[model samples]
Target: MLKLENITKRYELKKKTVYAVNNVNMTFHKGEFVSILGLSGSGKTTLVSQLGGLDQPSEGRIIVNGVDTSSFKQQDWNNYRKNNIGFVFQDFHLIAHLTAKENIEIALSLSGLTPKEKSDRAEELLALMGITEQRDQLPKQLSGGQKQRVAIARALSNKPDIILADEPTGALDPDTSVQIMEILQALAENGHLVIMVTHNKYLARDYSTRIVALESGKIISNEEVRPSKQYKDDQLSTDKSSLQFFTAVKIAMNNLKIRKKSTIFSMVSLIPSMVLIFGIMNLIFNMSGYKADFKPLLGDVLGKDNLLYVTPFEDEQLESTQKTIYKEVNRLNVYNPRIEPFKNTIIEPYTDDAISDMEDIEGVDKVLRNTYFDVIIDEKPFLLMALPPKAYASYQYGVPKKHYPEDHEEGIIMSSEAAKVLLQDNHASVKHLVGTDITFNIYNYKSAAIKLPSIMEEKNVIHTKVIDIMDISTKTKLMSNYHAGYIYVSYGYAESLRERFDLDDFTLFSYSVPDPFKSVVGVEVEGGFLITGPQLVADPLRHLRIKTSLQEKYNLFQFREFDLNMRGNNYSVKHTVILNDAFNKDSLAKLKEYGHVTKSRFDAYSVESAKKTNEYINYSLLSATLIAVVVILIPTLLVCVILYVSIILRTKEIGILKSIGARNKDILNIFTMESGILALSSGIISLVVALPLIQYVRNILESEYDLQASLGSNPMDYNMLGIITAFILSVGIITMIGLLPGRKASKLQPNTLLKHE
Candidate 1:
């Protein structure tokens, strides 16, 4: 039974009050086809809406089965609509994306029925409505009569107690209207309370067992044409209504499929942001992954864990300040150490005593020193790297042992670039030139510094056989030991040359300084007095004695005005100590006291200066990563806007769902899942495209700028951590932004949304 006690639905229009449904009392029983007949705007539709629980009565009680619904909550009303009443709208109100059967199943999806049970119930209802063959067709594919039949089937799918039809045949032809009225007449005969609101008086009178006429928001007549039959009460299901998660997903996917062009456009629009985010995140990882840079090389050729890169620590001064001072000296273009007292300059060297003390440490290992100096190969300038015999024992740069120098053979290994220059053939391979002899012309600092150009002769030349050639490929390009434009030779040969030619003792002076040569070298002029002049050569032994005396007396190594640091630069000549076994943290700490030590090359020692430098680098990398995040947010905000537009477009569909018992949470779920899918798909596609792009860019940097080491020890490698982080950040940002539109959609009222254009 259903009853309305003085139900009134009022509206305030600017300054006047209008009643869509005025105070009226009515009652209806089972097996009754009640037709509320009225013209347009006579409150017949409003009365039906109140009975169906689509809109609450503004000022009265709606009693169902002797119980008042005036105090019912929103959820209770939803349950009432889902379990006690079913709606048949004039426009059919079918979701365009769903098939006829699916439209019926959607109502069942909110119930506690199993998926198979829901499917069976939907198919049975379609068969009952005589639309079984059209069950798989969408609303747009069906004719008006078939669409109305599908709508009627969906309403009957839930087996609700009351069926409310508001102008159900308003859009149908005369014959189809007769068929729909017969269906409603049958439903009333099957022990159902059927309430029909329509303006067609002829159809209403023909189908109804009782007729109620209304005018001006008030009922004018209530007449029973036939006696109401008493039928047994059928207990309706009271399960709590909810939209399943997978059902929501299906609905969202269908929506996307219907608007596939816009969905694809949205996904493509986010690709650039995704690529930028991935690339910049990788760069940040490369900048900070110093240890990982060497993992491949160390594991393949040079053993990891025990190797250490060492540089002499002169004092506690900042390394940046020291680099600045060294750069100032480099500007002078002086290559000889003696010319500017650069050997024992501001930076101190590891003395023999200090080296012996290091050897005596608790975790002492073999120490091999490397020497770097400039040499002229034939007529071309080249840098020569002299390594000790023990240092040459490892197969450096993948070169086989056949190319290594034999014991005391005085052989040299040439770089491919250097060999290309010497042979005057860029396309020729240096591998064939192995075992060939090459001549190196050493610079005579004394001869060049004393203004004697003619004396620069072949007497200073040294001949050595080429034992091997190193190709500067990207594989080993980042290692300082395998730098291009250099020659590798034994340290013993360099030591023999040093002693044979007295290379460290050659000194020079400029006339620009006070007492250019006389005060420093003590040159006596023809007047029997020491005087400053450009052309003055005293005894080599006496000049050395005076230099040593000045070094001891004033510690003049620090006081040299023109302290040129060419041959003594750390990059040119440095020592690398490799531990035979892995050492602990304490042992590494002890080694730092003797020299700058790191597990990998280019890694700074863990001192205050190095820590400060690393801090700045980390800050810069973080800023770059944040900038990437902000850049990606551009597309994320666009996704938010797109989802908002999508919500606006689906307002009617949302209202249809709500009318069929979909909760606010269900609407929110559908939108959020759509956003998540969009973001995840964009992220995956972007990463797929970005990987190859990263390698291509790295190759350009290495070939054009020689920046392999600046990026990482291995420029072609990828960081998985960076890739994962980029994906998570991009997806999370987009999904969170999408929630804004989802929340807005959830807050909308079903009545307003159903009326949305």
Candidate 2:
């Protein structure tokens, strides 16, 4: 069943070629009990190793069942050892952790038997070896003879074609040695090709059917002592099977269970690395300000890139219209026409035709007009702004839901500062001022020169309720120069007021016509109508007093004199345009043709500034991540080196596993799984410990210093997906670190490893 043709195994030491087994030729058939006798360094064990496929011969070819093994691929050799041969050693190389029965079962795992069949087979082998009582005991708990018996059972478990025993009884007493020889003879009788290498000639002579003696590196003598016995029918063919993945994992798990302290220590060492990675991810998320609470502060007031503010520089038509209305109203015969034409003359209100023209502009989604006026609220001056319904609905943040005004509501939304002033108490909060009434005094400036009795009747005083309050502290541009505060009335309500107060009448005199030459009126002289030339010199002092008095009342009528140059045009000098798409260079240039354009939400500078800040933060975060990896690598490399040394220390165990049909990939996977488990355990523990601690620190800062130092306290708040990704990355790194040691252990030669042990 086996053939070795001129097989020679050589080794190189200091450039010297030493022949361990030189020019050897041997052949054996089934059912032959052969003993190879030689002194130390005489190549007895080397010959047996070459026969068992443990070490490849440097010269000559080994043939098994008519197939040459020298040309066999790696998998083929693994198969040859797993199915065709079994090995026993002087030290009885059974796994230290597994019980005797489990040790035998590991070999049976390579067979295609079911788990129950393997267990039953292991029990049968233990009974046959006369160690059934010791099947549950570990190798360390068994006697030296009992351990050898377990080793023999494990070797026979697979029902291999060849049994190679190198000094199987070398460490036993005389009685145990005799019993081990009888077991080998029994294997030979059962149709196995048993080849035993030993130094004792007495046992070889008594037990073997043939004896082969070696001197130096050649076979000096070969002869048969007695006739061979007939082979049994069950053991003629080789067992062809392989270790299953599940069985390999079971063995790996058992090995780890035996070394519990070492596994726990490895897991503990990974904690700091996990904490560092998780903490960095948390900081990056918080600094980006992408959390839920901060979304309101990002200013979605106009809805992304949809809104634009347009301001016009000049409009001649509006000026000409105002002048025509002034001249025509002066010819009318009326005490007070109630509504003045000049009041509606400012930037001629955009007509339907003009609005339609603007809507046709490329990229112009929608257009809305905004108007600001100075008004007296509770006797204090404040700026009042009118907004479209969309703009009103967009002001959700910092505005209470209970105070939100409907689209057609007549009530106004007051600024927090404006509410404080109207309530006459600086300490009043916005919530307490809701539903309060405030009187707004609106004056007509165009007809101020025309004075009459009951002039106060010309002034439009409306008592409006405060429906909502908005915090505008951070919006500096929106606040304007009104440090006293501001109020927001809907555009529809403000337009209704103009009609309700008869503000369009240019022929109406303010109760009485003013004597422009002598009367004192509160208005600014620079922009107001005055008699110049001879009229100024007629009463120079009186004119100067009149101008000063007019300047005082000038501000009261300031809202009317401002030219409404946008009249008869759909586009106002200052208007907001919502776009159909995000702003780009082409769209922005097109928008600039209509007016001075600015984004309603974010300015170009702010967006650019934010981008640069985020880039810097990302670069810094990458650097920190690299540093953290290096910090983790130092200990990880140390662990790998330590594991490498530990494998070197356990060389005997590795050899024993190889002898029992464990493949290189099997050994590699076992070690890698151990490392992966350790890394995953560490990551879970660190996340559990770090999240609550971070929350505690955040709470302390908030309570003690009124600081919003934390983005969130819950796991979901701090990027849970990122945490899981980090854990998987950590396990991969740890597995890579363990690969070197696992590879080293897998490549070790069983013959060389056993000699060291």
Candidate 3:
């Protein structure tokens, strides 16, 4: 059944020649009971390994059933081992986790037998070996002789025609050795060839039909105590196709079998992968979170129209902010307007027909009259206006400054803080101020208080009922300063005062392009001057105060340097100067433009701080995520090293498979299958624990952050793409690790290995 012809195997030592198997020549016939007798390092194990196709000669050919087994590819050799050859090691190398029955079943399963068949054959093999009663017990629970019996059962699972035993009874007592020898002799008598290598000459002489001898890694002699018979592969019941598949699976099983500890070590090495995935997912969630900011809120308030907010410059040049605003501006859609001066606060045309002409333009909602003055409130000055009450909603700070002073009148609202100062002494609160009488004095009016000097009041004063005092500083800074205080009466009240005072040189008329925030649907004003002197620009700035005052005091409606934005609808203003505030988000954007205005709120807060905050959020998240990936890289590398060492450790077994005809792909499949199983299973377990681990670590460190964190409380949204990313990265990383050993395994000299084994 097994024959070696002038087989020579050698190894190089430092300046020394060594022969592991030297010129070994031997023959074993079918049903031959043979033992190759030698001491340790006597080339006995090497010669037996060759007989089993676990090794090949460096200098001679090996024949099994008249086939030159040395010429077989890895796959062919593997097939030969699975169906034609059986091996029994001295150590009883049974898998610890599998039961005694299951240990045999593992062999049958790799032989491509169906589950039912594997179980039946496992039972049959055990029964034949007289270990049927111990089938249910694990290897650890079995005695030495019993374990050897189970191993013999496993070797018989494939129904091989020949069995090669390497010191099969080495670990057993003399009694157990005799028992094992008896079993081998019985199998040989049953027309199966059994060859063994051992140091026990008495046993070999007593049981083997033939005996061969070797010494110092060289074959010394060969003899037949009993007559040899021709051998055949008739005992193998498996077909070629079944054997091929079984060969593949058998090689695959070796990855798990021979590298058990390394597989476990490799599995436990994935902890960092688990931790990294959790941290990365968390960083993504954190980066996606955001709080409401004024810029976006202003966008909601103004719609899609491009609005530029400009106020009195502090550190920035007025023109520079204008350029900055225009730079970021999409000129085509926003129509990019710039700050320009106006000729008049009021247009003069006292006649009804002239007023009708002012009302005729398709673009001009009105060329109505307007006036500006600085009024003293809480002893501080605020921009005040005498305009039609219906048009008063255009003030920049009016939304935040809108307040109804106390004491009922025809109609009126005062800035909240301003009203507080007026109804009290030294800005003190007046509990009864809401309904109390309030007064105003004018130099050119009748109710200006008779005996004025005596009472220290003006003569032409006129007053109206105060409606309600309100806090309008919720969205703007105007009310935070005492200057927001004002005494606002209706535009009609101003008209009557002008009539009663016999006013002259005043024409309360609106001009071109007003309303700083609402740019479209308003008259066009022009700007291209570079006026330098303070006094020269002061009057224009005073006329421009309508724009500048709102620019400084409030940011209710957003603007860039020289743009206004409005959308939706505009209603006639009544009491509230903040008519846009009264509307919902949509309606507010369509706010009506006043006949005159300018940019009022750009660069209001810390632009640098906002920029810094944005940068910090983005870069911080990215850096943390990258660092985590790098940190987790250590375990991945460890797994690779572990797998590589495992492959090297099993070099001798790999050679065994190659001699039997496994392929490079077959070898790779085995290793990859082993690593792939561990990686995939560990990946699934890690992913399952990802979010919880994140939460656990977060809870563990929650006290460290200034903000509250709860692991985002969202399901991990891993899709096919993410899984594929992980698989590709893991395989790529691991394949690189497995490559060197895999190449070495692929390049194994099968003929040389067979002789050396």
Which candidate number maximizes TM-score?
Answer: 2
TM-scores of the models, in the order given: 0.59, 0.63, 0.50
lDDT of 2 by residue, 308-410 (tens): 6655533344345445545644644222233234334333345556656666777776776555443556555455656556444553344444545555679
Q: Pick the candidate with the highest lDDT.
A: 1
- lDDT for position 68 in model 2: 76
Q: How many residue pairs clash in each candidate?
A: 0, 35, 48
What TM-score does candidate 1 reach? 0.59
Residue 144 in candidate 3, Cα distance off native in Å: 2.1
Candidate 2: where are CA atoms >4 Å away?
230-250, 257-261, 282-593, 597-601, 616-620, 701-718
Instruction: List, residue by residue over 388-442, the lDDT tens digit for candidate 1.
Output: 5644467244444555565455878877866876788878877888889778755
Task: For residues 122-201, write the lDDT of model 3, one tens digit per residue.
Answer: 88888888888998897889999999998788777777888888889899999999999999998898878898988889
Give, for candidate 1, the lowest lDDT window spanning 10 residues: 557-566
Per-candidate local distance difference test: 0.68, 0.63, 0.52
lDDT assessment of candidate 3: 0.52
Worst 10 residues of 3 by lDDT: 564-573
- The ten-residue window of minimal lDDT in model 2 covers 532-541
Give the per-residue Cα lDDT of candidate 2 at 460: 55
